[model samples]
Target chain A: MVSKNQIKLISGLHQKKQRFANQLFFAEGVKVIQELLQSNFELEHLYTTLNDFQTVHASKRTVINEQELKKISALSTPNSCLAVFKIPAEKEIIHSGLILALDDIRDPGNLGTILRLCDWFGIEQIICSKETVDIYNPKVVQATMGSITRVNVSYVDLKLFLAQTKLPVFGTFMDGENIYQSKLPQDGIIIMGNEANGISEEIEKTVTSRLTIPRFGELQKTESLNVATATAIILSEFKRNS
Target chain B: MVSKNQIKLISGLHQKKQRFANQLFFAEGVKVIQELLQSNFELEHLYTTLNDFQTVHASKRTVINEQELKKISALSTPNSCLAVFKIPAEKEIIHSGLILALDDIRDPGNLGTILRLCDWFGIEQIICSKETVDIYNPKVVQATMGSITRVNVSYVDLKLFLAQTKLPVFGTFMDGENIYQSKLPQDGIIIMGNEANGISEEIEKTVTSRLTIPRFGELQKTESLNVATATAIILSEFKRNS
Candidate 1:
């Protein structure tokens, strides 16, 4: 049984400001909640319809009804469970081996998918511009499918970070060298741009290597690939021969 | 000025049953609407807040306020315009070139993103299992970002189609040959499976070539890639050498 105050607090966590203020974010479903439990994340509380998670201390979990679950769930169709975890302090950026840099990626879904891709490709670290969507956003946590536990993501001033990094910075462009023909390195930062815009102008200036994924479509009218998919292809190419 | 009846009709198109019964679907935003207008799609009507699409006959266009546009829109935030178009007859599936076979891809966004990827990679034809999500879903039309205009998508009995085809059939699997080291053909069908259930057992028997995208992550904990991103990587690998 959830109190009205508890419901209001969980709902407020849906917003970035509220999440930051409380240092709390919630993940839905058994899979994501389990992953967080196994990782370094600290459990603030758990609410579920089922009598699961026997390992969790009784004080940390509450057996709630479906109606109660729905009240706190961000998803239109509420999952069986939702668990709130404290947002750990940001870790130091691991500056080696195929770091992905994001230049103002605004979509929570895209950011989450990119984290999963980085986890898949063994790319450990992600550097996001301050303008990028907060990783603790519920949609992102859902989309990551528990990959949030595997990758290290840090939000920073992207232009300054790019300017100072010793590693070669790569970004895709239409006039750049074909990625298939280019010799990719094991250690570099691959920058993916915004949905509506490619990499920002100032960020583009800091890029040391410009690569292009050649369009095979007949008309070449299809302007761009989705950022998450683009990250998948770029990561695949960089790691294919490694 | 859209009448109450017109608003109801547009809202009904959100459902597959209503869309099929009416033989029409709607697209939101200026770019998507403009692409459909230029293509074979016959415009049923257009509603816009702006005085754009000057080429469209005045009889086919209506100037409406943002509130009215919201009433007809599927998005949380309505674009400047929405246009309904006659659902064109499905074209014959082209038997040649690299074909993308989707086995019950249920997400409208994934379907749309895959269509866009196919357009980018020059894969002109897509064969969808009858169980796959409708290509004309409003979310799909929006996510396609106008690539729906370039690619031809047809829904059919995917298993039977695979059994009868003379070309080699390919599908990704956990124990399959590593894609990077394998010899990929330019004229074959690549099957991407359902979001949660990979490929169905019956359809798995029809795949002549089994390939896998190797995982590079240290923990190998990422269970799978999103269907659209997987499609992007596979298509890139196949076309890179050509």
Candidate 2:
């Protein structure tokens, strides 16, 4: 049985500002919650429709009805459970391997999908511009499919970060060298741009290597690949050779 | 000015049943509408806030306000315009080059992204299981941006189609040959499975070539790649060598 105050708090975590203020964010479904439990994430509370998650202490777990679950759920169809976890301190950026840099990616789904791809390819860190969507956004957390626990994502002044990094910065552009023909390195930063716009002008200047995924379509008018998919191809190319 | 009946008819096109019943579907935003207008698609009507699309016959275009567009739009944030187009007859499947086969791809966005990828990679044809989401879904159309006009998508009984095809069929699996090392053919079918359930058991039998996109991450628990991104990577590999 969740109290009125608890419902308000959980719902508030849906927004970035509220999540930052409380230092907490929530994830739904058994899979995501279980992943968080197993990771370094500290659980604030757990609300479940089923009397499961027996390992959680009695005080931390609340058995709630579907009606109560619906009230606090960010999803249209509430899952069997939702678990709130305290947002851990932002870890230091691990700059050694392939690091993905985002220049103002606005969609939560794209951000989440990129994080999952990073997790898949063993890319440890993602550097996001301040203009990028917040990682704690409910849609992102849900879309990550629990990959949120593994990746280290940090939001910083992207231009400044790019300027100082010793690693070669790579970004895709139409006039750039064909990615297939280019020699990709194991340690470098691959920057993916916004959905509507490719990498911004200032960031483009900082790119030490510019690559292009050549279009095979006959028409040549299919504007661009979706940013996340572009990242997948780029990451695959970089890793396939290594 | 759109009449009451016109609004009702346009709104109904949002559903697959209504779209098929009326033999029409709608696309929003100038870029998508313009692409359709340029293609074989016959425009049923056009509603716009701006006095644009001057090439369209005056009789077929209506100047409407934001409120009226909201009433007819399927998006939460309506674009400046919406144009309904006749759902052109499905073209014959061109089985020659690399073809993408979707086994019950249920997400409209995934279908759209795959279509866009097909366009980008010059994969001319897509074969879908009957259970796959309709290509004309508004969300799918919107996500495709304009690639909808270029790619040929046909829904069929996938298992039968695979059984009869002369070309080699490829599908991703855990124990499959590593894609990077495999001798990928330019003329073959690459099957991407359903979002939750990879490939159904019956369809799995029809796949002649089993391929895997190896994971480089330390923790190999990352389940699978999102269908669209996987499509992107696989398409890249097929085209890169050619």
Candidate 3:
């Protein structure tokens, strides 16, 4: 059974300020909850429909009914289980592995998709700007599709972070080095920008290397690639070459 | 002033059956509507609050006040312009350039994003399985930003289409060859599968080559890349190497 406080806490996670104040976010879906349980992320409270908590991992979890689960779920159809987990503490950047740094990315879905991309490419650390979409948004959580466990997302001053990093910051732009021919560093941050605008002007100024995914057609009418999709392509190339 | 019939017709285009029956689709926003005007795609009607249309490409455009523009808009919040255009007939397969075939892609936004990707990567045509989402869906239209103008999308009996195509048919699978190391053909039909399931079994049989975007993590729990993003990466690599 869910208590009033539990419902309130879970609901509060929907708001960015509330998520920040509590330093926790909610993840639902049976598979997503199970993945969270198996991962290193700290679980605050887990609510499950099964009284017995059937899965081997779910055994340690708390049980609740469908109604309780639905109340806490951002999804119209709540999964069998829901869990609240602490936001993983900021970890020291290893700085050697390929990291993704996002500048002023406002879309939760985009950030979540990027997180999934990072997990796919085995990108260890995503050093995001404070202005980047909060990783813990329920929508972002949904989009990550259970990748939130493996990848460490840290919010930092993006402009400062980009300037301080020793490795070359490769960012995308209209006119830049042809990615096919460019020598990609084995280790560095790839900065993606906001949906409407590329990277912010301040962040763009700090980029050491400007790279472009060469356009295919002869004509110059097609607008820029979707940010998440662009990340996937760029990451695939970088990982493939490395 | 926006006529009642115009409102009904614009609203009706939102559905797949209606779009097909009416032989029209709608596009919104300044960039999207402008792209349709600039590109070779046929525009049946153009309504805009902006005056720049007459100065450049108002081939057969009508000027409307912001209120009328709002009345005709399909967006959540109205934009400055909206246009209803004929769904350009899918051009005959030139059979020379790279092509992408989608199987049962139910999401309109995914379809639109894929079209944008197709346009950006210079993929001239997309062959969709009969069950694939409608290309004219307003959400798909909105999501494409503008690339929908350039990519020729056709729905066909994928089986028949695959049987006819002379180029290699490549499909992505978990057990397939590493896309990076595999010998990718210069021109072929890349068959992207259904959203929930990978490729359909019938179509999978027709795929001459099977390629996999290898996952980085050893654990097999995380969700694979979204179909749209995967398409973007695959198309980019195909074009890049070619």
State the displacement of the C-alpha of residue A162, model 3, in Å, after optimal TM-score superposition: 1.7
Candidate 1 lDDT over A160-229, as tens digits, reads: 9998999999999999999999999999999999999989999999989999999996698988999999
Better of 1 and 3 by TM-score: 1
DockQ metric, candidate 3 = 0.66
Which candidate ranks first by DockQ, i.e. highest?
A: 1
- For residue A91, give model 2's deviation from the true position in Å: 0.5
lDDT of each: 0.95, 0.94, 0.83
- Pairs of residues at least 3 apart in sequence or in different chains that clash in candidate 2: none
Q: Could you tell me which 10 consecutive residues in candidate 2 chain A have the lowest summed lDDT?
A: A214-223
Worst 10 residues of 3 chain B by lDDT: B51-60
lDDT of 1: 0.95
- Per-candidate DockQ values are 0.87, 0.86, 0.66
| Model 1 CA deviation exceeding 4 Å by range | none
- Candidate 2, residues B93-120, lDDT tens digits: the string is 8979999999999999989989999999
Q: lDDT tens digits, residues A1-242, model 2?
A: 99999999998999899999999999999998999999999999999999999999999999999999999999999999999999999999998999999999999999999998999999999999999999999999988998998999999999999999999999999999999999999999999999998899999999999899999967888889999999999999999989
lDDT of 3 at B48: 75
Local accuracy of candidate 1 as per-residue lDDT tens digits, B1-242: 99999999999999999999999999999999988988899999999999888889999999999999989999999999999999999898999999999999999999999999999999999999999999999999999999999999999999899999999999999999999999998999999999999999999999999999999966999999999899999999999998
Clashing pairs in 1: none
Q: Write the per-residue lDDT of candidate 3 for residues B93-212, one digit (tens) a residue.
A: 657778899989998878988988888888888999889987888889888888877777888999998998789999989889888887777778999988778898889989998888
